[model samples]
Target chain A: MPAAIETRNLTKQWGDLKAVDKLDLVVNEGECYAFLGRNGSGKSTTARMLLDFIRPTGGSSELLGGSGSDPDIRARVGYLPGDLNLPRTMTGRDAFNYFGGLRPSGESDVRDSLVERFGLDPTRPVRELSTGNRRKVGLILAFMNNPELLILDEPTSGLDPVLQEEFRDLLAERKADGATIWLTSHVMAEVARVADRVGLINEGKLVKELTFEELRHQATTEITFGFAEPVPPSAFEDVTSVAAVTQDGVDLVLSLNGPVGAVLKRAAELDAIRVETEQNDLDTIFIQLLSGEEQS
Target chain B: MSATLSVYRRWIRDRRLSTVSWTLGIVVIIVATAAFYPSLGSTTASIADGSDSGEAMSSLLGLSSGIDPSTPLGYLWISLYANIVPWTLMALGVALGTAAIASDEDTGALEYLLSGPVTRTQVAFARFAAAVSVLLLVSFLSGLSMVLSLPFFDLTESVTTTAPDGSSTTAPGATVGDIATGTFSSFAVALGLTGIAFLIGAATGRKGITLGGASAVGIGGYVLYTLSSMTSSLDFLTWLSPWRWYVDDVMLINGLTWDVTLPFITATLCLLIGWQAFLHRDLQSS
Candidate 1:
């Protein structure tokens, strides 16, 4: 079987800027691939190109073994844009019916069930809804088709903690049911929960690709030590455990991936005022990647 | 149901308020204007006798030949149907056509719609067709208002025409055929402008450009036609204006002419070019 999503040298250029530059990616069938990128990193642009909303300047992309412009292929895919804007007069139910009616036997039962699950008021016009509620409507529309593939941009952006958890659970269920999902998100924790693999993109280029196991096994720790006097970040540079260091006022925050004992001993020897340690997860790795720090 | 048809239905449903308001407003204008026909009586004929100011007034109002202002059809032409009704219908068309693609695209709603199982071709055709249908409906209502008031205005009376050479002739008064054909010609002119708006909207996907550009072209065309009518040196420019095809013969009084088909032909050409441009261009992000 062909990969659910594939791209070869997919690029988009606007005058002097390359929004997506020579990107090559593939998501196998039933795989949950998360694209991690910062704001204006071309993640949304890639999603738009994949759906044929914006034509790529060069190279190509395929969705579900067919071109993005193919209506037949599109019918089997569910998409949610990052910024969801509906007509002001259309109620949630009206939107559901309008978009759903376009598909061949669009899943109404699924739509209704998802609406109930998300606690969406289908009777209310979308313009009156809050940002989070509008996101709920977008989510319901994406999941309504029971599609074979899903392309979601910032899927859980405005959801509260409880609803975010519900969304993650729903995503896991969909994954287990053998659907391929490709999503872009700034929320590292959400990606850590549901993503099987992740690719980090920076300035329109893929910087790193890591599996869930590799990401989890990072096991990096953040240690913050306050000195009586200001200390430079280079003070603990030779320690094998120290991956990166940043100074905040009189405090030195060290990212330790190996063993923290050596760094702790050194800090103690230096007569630090206070030393605090916390486990640093995927978010730390993301920041490190974007900030030009070398990964261990 | 066909996807194109479904889109058409949805678009029409989306603009139901606009269609209702324009259609009702036109009907009211036509009725109110027709009510004055009885009171004006012979004064209408005196204006058509062509005094220096009267001729200038007729030209400015787009009351050209084949219309005798003494009769009901000619009265409506000089009073409201010729310029007012057509311009109002054209305004509706321009508004609808501009919103058809550009408004949806700018609002970010069209991107979501395209994500469905529909194609860009379907969207383009559906929107254009829906705008045309609503325009025709407005024109139909305008004609119906005049037809319903025909008996009230005693429009069945024959019109006596006095030629420039001092020759007199009699012409039959307004009939249902005249009303139907006149409405069709009016609709054709509006549709032509609507098509231009659709083309601009599809090509650019910007509401401001679509509305402003289409209005400029329409108003410019009218200005050119009016100036050409007054100056023989600029008369050739009339061929390019829908106003010429519309008012040159004054359809309600003169009966139908071959010029009625020109707008549809031009509109189809615009649609083809626009549909292709829209299908290939990148959708503007909201």
Candidate 2:
């Protein structure tokens, strides 16, 4: 089957600034893809283009195998805008009901389930809800309809830790049921936990695309070994490219990039005991990628 | 089609309280004016009777009271046109109609609505229909007030008499039916103004600017028409104003002519243009 969401060289320009530039993305069915980017990095712009909220200036996008602004395409897609400003006069329950009524085959208990799961107060007016509560309401509205494709921008924002974990699980369940999810976030840990494949965007361009396993391989490992005797600076030569090494008396800390076997052999040759190795998380990989450092 | 109608129903539910308040406010103004100016009827009668004093007063009040005081239908016509109809009704219509669409967009609720299965045409038409309904309701209620009060003034009686040239005078009572027809003329005028305001709101996407700019142009047109009517040098300018076609005294006392058709036609054209603009413009997120 065709990809659930595809953009062909999609470009959006606001005056001289290119908000999104010639972005070509294909999100496959039943896969959870995370778009990782820093502030002003075109993630939100890309999401908006996918949803047809704003017309692309130089290229085109398709949602659910249909071209721009197609009604059938929109019917199968659910979107949560980066800026969620609901009407202040309406209650959270009313807003959800209004959107729910628009769906052709919406679940009857979706709203109630969401309200109960999130512990959201249905009686409170939207204006009275806190920012986090408002974000919860927006999440419920976007996810409750069980749309075929879900495009969420910064989905976990303003949510507490507990709700964030619940949201991640909900996304996983949706993916298991053959739904496509296109998520954008600056939170690397969350992206690492949920995203099967990740794309890093910078200055309106997709700079890197890697699967979770590839990302783990590219990450560095921390090695700490206590030497029986003081070792020379060249004692670990030809073992690995150490990013940083700090020695406190006899215990030595080394941040190394490469196979763990190399580091282990080098430590054994140095007569070191009690050596520990821990893999670097997604946060380290993100910082290294965005900072113009290549991962070998 | 059902979805389109649902949007209109939603709009009515959202704005019912505000509509009632606006209509009530306009009705209060009309009633107060009618109560304070009871001689307004006598002045209309004198002008209809064609007496010298009646003629002077009719000129001063900018009215034409027909040919006989005993049958003062002309005065009733003047009251309906000038005081009861267009002035208050049209202002309310423009304010309420412009707010109906532009306010939703301004506050970002429009995106939520448009993102649904409803098309842009459905939204535009539904909003237009709802606004027009509110305008008609206000006009009808105000007209009803005037109709119910006619018997209190004993102005519902018909009479017959002998003329100076031996001709018989058969004058008819100013029935509720006549009053309704007269009110409808003003309704047509107000409807046109409401359409113009709706067009402005759609084009600009700003409720305040649309309401303010339309109100200025509307009130300015009325002022220009009144000023031009008083001056021989500016008489030609009166034809350019929308208010010229809606003048209460002229429509009620002199009766509407082919000249009144221009405003209604212009209004329909403007509404079509507005709908087209709404359909093509990108939905604003606001």
Best-fitting candidate, scored by TM-score: 1
Write out the backbone clash pairs for model 2: B48-B65, B48-B68, B49-B68, B49-B69, B81-B248, B82-B248
Maximum-DockQ candidate: 1
- The digit string of per-residue lDDT tens for model 1 on B1-286 reads 8789988998888788878898889888888877887787568777775764544467766556835677777787788767888899889989988978998998899899998889999999999999888888888888888889777877766778678999998766678788888788888888899999999999999999999999998999888887776678888877888887787778876778888889899889989999999999999999
Give the proportion of true interface contacts each model preserves, from 0 to 1: 0.71, 0.25
Model 1: DockQ vs. true structure: 0.76
Identify the runs in model 2 with alpha carbons over 4 angstroms from their true place: A86-89, A221-239, A244-255, A259-288, A293-296, B37-85, B153-174, B230-240, B254-263
Collision pairs in model 1: none
- Displacement of residue A63 (Cα, Å) in model 1 is 0.4
* Cα lDDT of model 2 by residue, B97-179, tens digit: 58756777776677656655676777788888888888888888877877776666555666576768999976776677766
The chain B TM-scores of all candidates, as shown, are 0.93, 0.80
lDDT of model 1, residue B235: 81
State which candidate has the highest lDDT: 1
